[model samples]
Target: MTASPPDNSAQMASPSYRLAVFDQDFLLSDSLRGVRFLLEFAKADLALKAWGVRSTVVVFGSARVRENGDPDHARWYAAAREFAALASQRGGAFLEGGPVRDNVIATGGGPGIMEAANRGAADVGAPSVGFNITLPHEQEPNAYSTPELTFRFHYFAMRKMHLAMRANALVVFPGGFGTLDELFEILTLRQTSKSPEIPVVLFDEGYWRGIINFDEMARRGMIAQKDLDLFGFAETADGVWQELVRRGLKPHEDLESLTKSP
Candidate 1:
């Protein structure tokens, strides 16, 4: 069950019906049931509110992807590191024409590429944001997160909702099934127009090519050529810059369409 589903949204008047969705830490801190808890979390969504949020790029990759001293692995890690630095720069390549500098790096709050991205941002003296998962593996929250931005989720779907809640774009690095699952989820949302439109940049062309056979799917007409345009590629920070600009960067945004009750 997704932690803290809005199951109590309508029946919030009954105090006796309150249900705790988190451990004492989260439950006590964030509260549960009633309009108070819902209002607070709702404000959280509105407060960061996309426009006020630190302009950010969501970075995804495998927790297992490692950097060995081997040539290819070394090159990949170095490139990933460099890419993050550029993206985090104040008015750097990723933000060349935008008002945002000090772009916050957002990650899964675990090891491997997520840690690498957060670490890379930290190298520049900028702390990243980690939206951690509360899984059995217990993805530990990384150390690079800014105190205010670090968060943990009891539900993968909830974590994902938060991930996209303020994301301006996506920079997916090499990862496995988890990564693919996330990629497909975001794509499916975008394809169906269920979620707000955003750019998704696939990092590491070599890894992407080796792992997924999008071409074969295309040949068999399992997917359309136009559908393939849903995502672009980036190998170096420079390439990422080209695409971000080409796409006409949008604000790291949030939902403004929900009708306000008069």
Candidate 2:
């Protein structure tokens, strides 16, 4: 693939800047592109190691939610803290249950609940990884990300690949468009048979219900009942771990031959 610019969020802001100069069957060399990609990959790899994680639970959320926000009785921060801890426990369970301990924490590497999750993981002595995007606003990688684990990417696809490649499970916290983007991508992967059948746990039951009405969709027969079975929801950290253990989550790599391949 040819090189592309960072944060291509805008169209042709610079006339001199060409996106990809493909020359026939041979793509022209973009020195900076290769360097940056390698640097990012290396950084991510290092961050993964720094935490001594054997596996990870990819957590998704907004970078804007305050530790004090509320539309209901519970604060988002409380929920996020549970998300981080629950994923870790579930990750640990997968490890002891004949699965490798890729049991580290992973995130979009941004703010909001993502930061909370990562922070909680760190508090419990597990390392966390952040696959940050090269977005225009509110997309910066959170400070809680391990120094080496932080990545700013030109390609959301690549960032996602990093998230999916080692993920044993996914815990989605409340978020906006970006969170929805990652959330749906994983769902589509499972629906289209592109991703492993790993457990997808959505945090905050009420908030989720307020945002999207999956049950109503099922009622309308827009999605089959089996399709609706693709994910689960949880309230407390312990309950999240219980669901994962009950369903039997394993590393994506171990389940590869039996799952949908990219």
Candidate 3:
């Protein structure tokens, strides 16, 4: 065989040639997409675990719900805030300062109910988690979340995984598509036995019943009637906490009284 032409691989190489793993160009390539996905999962996992977040009470709701300015907005926002504070105080989040704790409030990390819940945790001097997603519009980490515990993810799947993987309970406020998607995702996981039993409390029975006709679906033979027991309805923050406790949630010893402090 003719001698190969003078090799120019070194000359042709770019910054990607040395320390390829650290090269942004190489890392952003299609071939590395899977690696990127794993990095997303691993980054959040390590950070949360390191922070001693053993379990979370995930709050899902509409980013449109406001703390004021409208009737529905006021109702949902207040309920979410109260619920988050209750969960942090009673759900083992502050029971001990160690490598494992339960019921740290976790949110989608955007405005509206997410902000309200995160703000509620902060109100009680508790650290809360925010799994913010990189969205094209209207999605950013609210200021209330603990800075170190707040995480941003480019993939919804990874974000959802982090949301569900450590959830001890789920409190859903009235929301649109995104909220429904997350609620059903967890429900499906529980229904299929992919995840352990997660107490799901849907706030505002009227709102949810209007949006989703669970009874109708069951009557029509779409979903099993027993599926109705998968979740419960509540109108107030205290009701949500009570329902969770009835479903076998154990509160921290310090939470002997379930009264909401004024």
Number of the top-ranking candidate, with TM-score as the measure: 3
- How do the residues 1-262 of candidate 1 rate in per-residue lDDT, one tens digit apiece? 6577567656765544555543444455534434444544464455344323545677888777666756655665666666677677632213334443334678888877787788788787665677787787667877766556677666576677777766667788878898888888888887788876778888877789888888887889987877788888987876875676566544222112122324
Candidate 1 structure, TM-score to reference: 0.71
Q: For residues 1-262, write the lDDT of model 3, one tens digit per residue.
A: 8987998888668675668777888899899999999999999898888888878899999998889849989988988999899888888777475446678999999999999999999999999999999888857799999999999999999999999998888999999999999999998998888998879999999999998999999999988898899999899999999998887666654233433444
RMSD of 2: 10.5
Candidate 3 local Cα displacement, residue 17, angstroms = 1.3
Note the Cα lDDT for every prediction shown: 0.67, 0.71, 0.88
Between prediction 1 and prediction 2, the one with superior lDDT is 2
Minimal lDDT window, size 10, model 2: 20-29
- Return whichever of 1 and 3 wins on TM-score: 3
Candidate 3 ranges with C-alpha deviation above 4 Å = 1-15, 95-97, 252-262
Clashing pairs in 3: none
- State how far residue 198 of model 1 sits from its true place (Å): 1.8
